[model samples]
Target: MLEQLLIFTRGGLILWTCKELGNALKGSPIDTLIRSCLLEERSGAASYNYDAPGASYTLKWTFHNELGLVFVAVYQRILHLLYVDDLLALVRREFSEIYDPKRTVYNDFDETFRQLRMEAEARAEELKKSKQMVKPVNNSKKQGQAQKAGFDKGNKKREGSSAAGATKKGWFSSMFQSIAGKANLEKGDLEPALKALKDRLMTKNVAEEIAEKLCESVAASLEGKKLASFTRVSSTVQAAMEEALVRILTPRRSIDILRDVHAAKEQRKPYVVVFVGVNGVGKSTNLAKVAYWLLQHNVSVMMAACDTFRSGAVEQLRTHARRLHIPIFEKGYEKDPAIVAKEAIQEATRNGSDVVLVDTAGRMQDNEPLMRALSKLIYLNNPDLVLFVGEALVGNDAVDQLSKFNQKLADLSTSSTPRLIDGILLTKFDTIDDKVGAALSMVYISGAPVMFVGCGQSYTDLKKLNVKSIVKTLLK
Candidate 1:
């Protein structure tokens, strides 16, 4: 199935994207491929086609010289390269009609790109039906093979009588055996079942080690167990898998900001929460979403635009606050974020705000100075909770970010007690479709439960994580 289509400039800026596979292509996989192809093209390499390492989907890309653009398509199953070429041609034609590179910005053409996506989807359906109609028949070969087995009329008559007698006996025997086997569920059977489940998890993007561990937990729970009379093996295994995931997902799952704010109000202190993550992972927007969520609960909230490093960081948060009708605390650009954060909390206390949500500048994990600054801010404020906001579409990159952030922050804490990210706020979760490996991977890697998921642009889009629903989707 055609999963996603992305169009980007040669400079690695995404112009437009249509997601059919349910997950948005937000992070490293697309970035790495675009960077590599652009580098190869710059080096005079002819190849433009590339496959994502360990990805379940196939990626095909082509470039347009005049626009300096790249068109890439992702599919769950392989299709002819020529089909991708045809789709790209259609996309280019539609885009060219609406977009003038010299005058129109790419962001303004989202509606045009969306219409092109609808057309592509309709064409894909037609191609699928045509392929099915032209599928080669194999029934004749099967019949010939049966004839070659040499069953003459007399032999058939004799075999038919024997088979009829055997069938009656076999039915009774099979029923009895099935009943007996219900009480004899063994390790040998569990191993194969567990292996199948582990493979399924990996196909959905769960890390191999995490999948194996999950399977092991399932096996331990199921080994030497007795199946109920009406219960099937698959059903029993699936239940065990669900239970295991629920256990992993349930720890530290509470995200009742309103309750916490009320309690903090009783103490005359603002319930402080600091948001942290890498660049372009929707930290600012997500902070705004959280603010909106609090407002819905009838709690007064204030925002701290402590992300003073980026040129428009303060402005972005300011825009969200203004729209939400919430007050903001900011020290403008180039100021120390740690000082801004401290001042914001002080302002929140003075204003009698119930909660202060501090927005910090996004920094790469390997950027030591920025990482230290983040650690310093956390230490200085000692906030009620530090939440790591990450994109669910980035797969394991989200895991790496949380793991490193947790580790670095723990190391920098001066108190004998270790401090880690209390929970995760997974953004773009609604776009992930069936590939939910990032959620499992992040929890397994960082041992932090997901507090909230960002599903859309509205404040109401931020929702609490549902363990049962998530496990069902993953297993499905």
Candidate 2:
């Protein structure tokens, strides 16, 4: 039987996955295997199979050469190999109907996947029933005997029906009565509700551990609280969950960049804000957006193109600065970023600019030399606030990046106040659907609140994080 299906792009990004109810493939092992398959170059076959402890794994994939997409279906049970091709065709047809690679973000296709899963399961069920009906029956005498036995069983069942109905009715009545009579919330009563919430969070790409923790916190808060009535149970549980999420999101709410810039102007110095993150996370664009925001508030802003390593990085910042009509400081390619940053601050001060936004090279958190250089820039320049720019689609990977960056900076700093990430700026927020787990995981892991969310390509798209909006999104 078809147990599960997973679709992945060539980059090994999980586009969507569906599993039979109550049968979730262990995520880590499957992820590891899929990553291996994606990285493997020797295989030219369209299909592959592997044997594992609980289930047999089969991979059937179709590649869209022009789009560079690899559509993979993972079947757990042994079935005819021909069906795999049919399944892939179905997926490809459905994907083409709803998704446009250039226009639509892939993360928002959960509902489409749900519909596909429903159709696939229905087809599988029909196949199974057809197979069962094809089995031949025994002789007429044996059939007559089976019929007589079935009649006897049915008569006995009817005779016992009243007793069984009474028992079931009493049990259900007691359960509802207990729920309505102010009984303290128990694990049995809360498990189903919390599981649903946890599942919802997981579907949003939140890490399992984080989702479990959030649900646990909500469950703990609701535990031992007397339920006013069965009718009110859902609302009461939702309230508890909302309160828990708000608590996580509410800390460090005030960003107030304009106020800070004005204060710095009074002190005759430019306030510095540095943007840091891995490659292609919209650091330069977001910095420009911030500059536009500051410029709107009448704060003079200058940008420092400190990203000296990556080719064309400086020019990218310069382009954004030009488009925004803001001054930019660049020392050209291969120049020391720290020196550029320091000189930029000096220039901003000399120009009477209220704020300087320094753009740094994006390097992986594990890249030691680059990380050390980043720490040096932070220590040498001592920016007022160091913000980590993260991609919303990366989920827990963003958390890992922030944690390592904070740790690296803390290790490099000799000052009593280590240079920790002051806040996070999550880019591509609008590209994601409801899976706001990156926000929760980033804050919870790094202890840095989200300061701003970059929702769109426009300058006006940057908005401060709203607690109610975030909580509502999570619950929704």
Candidate 3:
């Protein structure tokens, strides 16, 4: 079956073993059949096409002494490439359910799996022990062992807790004491104390190098400087150090970000939320999603279908409002969106609504006249949050839009008409793999805190943005 297959590319000679396969298949039963297959270039690579009249076939393969293996099956001349490369990651991912253990070459595969299972088990056990060695608590264990204890929820309150004035003071007091002692120690003769501690630690069987390193670390701490762990100080700490350095160098202004969001919220006497984005970027959909989320959160919401310039946009918002059983304020295509937004805010104020999200016109942030229109809306009925929504699929384009909008916000200011970007909302998050990275990079580099992320078009897809959460998800 393997001998019947051919490997051909545009400019390279077939491997020695592939040539041997051709020779071995020359007189075989399928030799004449294999010769009929044709080659074509696709995606800068060559593919083999085998066209037969009425053949239904299945293919399976194994490699005992090579870097790669492939198994192709042709059914009525429709071919399926089953596996590739030494890793066989595709086979391990797909078609894993159908790989039979009873086949000829697959018997060896079973042996290989067994070996892998044993190695995995051994590694897991080693990991368990290493985890046990750590000082940190693992919450998953049902019971605790001595010296490796977890949080004891059962014993949270002791039978006789403590005397009235007893127990160590607050964290600040203890920390102050520690700091004072360290300060005094820094002023004292260090060589003798270091030698004494080193001798004691070594006597307790600590390695000489480890003791010396620990002493140096302790000295740094005594001098009121943060001590670096030996692991962090190691020469092989490139990846971790680089990440730490980046974080240190690229500090975020969480306080300022929060303050701006709060200021925007406070500045609006009539609390309004305006969704801004370009056309075909899910701006209206995201506004509806936000409304749905607010409704789910038990906040009284009214959506303003103010995208009068776009056909069917009002209907789209109205449809979502009906499905969600939330009220909507909308006008037909000819009305101005700014007027709609103003009316919506007035209606929300009269109804004592918690939130009123206004879906504005579909225009690029770079459009100056459109931005002027947005500025007019803000001036007339100041919004609590001016969320700049953008597509995650646009990557760097999203960054450009954010920058332009932020700049406009900065430029469009009178004493009464102050505008600053409160937050950013990123949409189509689930469809893009690197969206989190791109979005975080946008926020980090542009100094904008992402407020919400739209993982899906559904109402429940709106998630409050946590920078740490985004980072963790992206790394994963």
Q: Tens-digit lDDT track for model 1 on 225-301? A: 67667666777888878776776777644567677778889999999999999999999999998888888888889
TM-score of each: 0.62, 0.62, 0.46
What lDDT does the true structure give each of the candidates? 0.77, 0.77, 0.54
lDDT of 3 by residue, 1-476 (tens): 22232221212222212222243322222222222221100111123333233343432222211112233322222443222222233333232443443432332344444343355446656766887895977885655564344345435445236432245455664466444432222314345655665565444333454345444533432332222332212221222222422342233444342344334446543447788877788887888787776666556678888788878888888888888888888878878677988888788767766678888887887787777777777777777677788887777677677777777755765434367666778888778753444564455434456777888756788877665554444333
TM-score of 1: 0.62
lDDT of each residue in 161-264, candidate 2, tens digit only: 97888887988877786566555667577788888888877777777877777776566446555677555556776777777677667763467777877788
Order of quality (TM-score) = 2, 1, 3
Candidate 1, after superposition: displacement of residue 467 in Å? 1.8
Candidate 3 achieves a global lDDT of 0.54
Cα deviation at 16, candidate 3, in Å, is 77
Worst 10 residues of 3 by lDDT: 36-45
